[model samples]
Target: MDKVFNAITTSGEEGVFQTELCKSFSLDSRDGSRLVGNLEKQSLITREKALYNGRWTYKLVVKKSIPVDAIEQKPIDLSSVEGAPCICCPSQHLCSIEDESNPISPAKCQIIEEWVTISFNKFMMIQQTEII
Candidate 1:
């Protein structure tokens, strides 16, 4: 399968014919067709009918390549935002202007002010330490 896909990709945008693949890999018509069908089913390639020496034949074209890096992507670490105020706020979901009950709006929210003040104080302390 890899060999067949590699061969098709090597042909680039021009693509390669089913008969060409059969000849190149020494595969029979049934096996070649089955391989192409599988590649099409997986969305790795596309097959289209075209004129080949006065006969209709299929072309094996690569749709897209599976990125090796994408398969091994590093998981995101949200450690920095672990204790953030908005995320920890108990009334966050109920905080809205339209809601009449327990309407903890953002403009006059005490929770946000306290959190911001504490964070600012910590930042100032860090700055003072650096200056000293």
Candidate 2:
């Protein structure tokens, strides 16, 4: 979705972006997924993992049809906002990943994979699998 939205807004009627272009940032394709949304929700046409040239890219549409700046935003104080983490408008409510308010800071993300999912097969260990 992020890719599609970027393709449209960044390129225009051509509406295209290559994931390889992301290499400049050194982003790993399998590290995580990107979503383009107004308030933390993606809408309109979306694409995912479309490898055109040894790269993965997701294409999606923007609901408002506006371009959002990908540059790092200055961290803000989340405590001031009632629903800090739940804020849809980062400009108004959410703080930058650098802000202490951010449970996961941008700096933290850069140093490590902030969102690493580890799967352990408890069934294979000492626990039995149960149907919930």
Candidate 3:
């Protein structure tokens, strides 16, 4: 991290400073120009671009903001007892069954098949916690 910081701020009296990416990281163009763009195609550095002093240089592109990705979900058939009856009705049916003995009416457990997926965003926020 220190090396990265140094490379980013590697400025001399001539005012020319640059650093090749040591590792894949989120770009912080506070000062100096870090090369960007696909190096294979051509140089991505803009001499006039900067987050502060009008100079940002880098070879690899570091996208700061990231969009979230939606999660996928699939529906499945629910397991049900064909002849299970609701407490209220003697005949087998799919409904709530209330207990008469207890003042609190508890319904008979039912088979509920649900499907859900978790969505995640590829956000790169500042680290809030440090692992000691």
TM values, all candidates: 0.49, 0.27, 0.15
lDDT by residue (55-122, candidate 1, tens digit) is 77898789976789779888899754545778777888878877656558876688877877887888
lDDT (C-alpha) at residue 59 in model 3: 32
lDDT of 2 by residue, 11-86 (tens): 5444344354345335455432343333124355344446566655644323444555865578786533333233
Candidate 1's C-alpha runs over 4 A off are 65-132
Each candidate: RMSD to true structure?
10.6, 18.4, 22.4
Steric clash pairs (candidate 1): none
> In angstroms, how far off is 87's CA in candidate 1?
26
Q: Can you list the residue pairs that collide in candidate 2? A: 4-59, 4-60, 46-60, 47-59, 75-96
Q: Over the full model, what C-alpha lDDT does candidate 3 score relative to the true structure? A: 0.32
Report clash pairs, candidate 3. Answer: 33-56, 33-57, 34-56, 34-57, 34-58, 35-57, 35-58, 35-59, 36-58
**Top candidate by TM-score:** 1
Task: Order candidates by TM-score, high to low.
Answer: 1, 2, 3
Cα error, candidate 2, residue 129 (Å): 64
List the lowest-lDDT window of 10 residues for candidate 2: 110-119
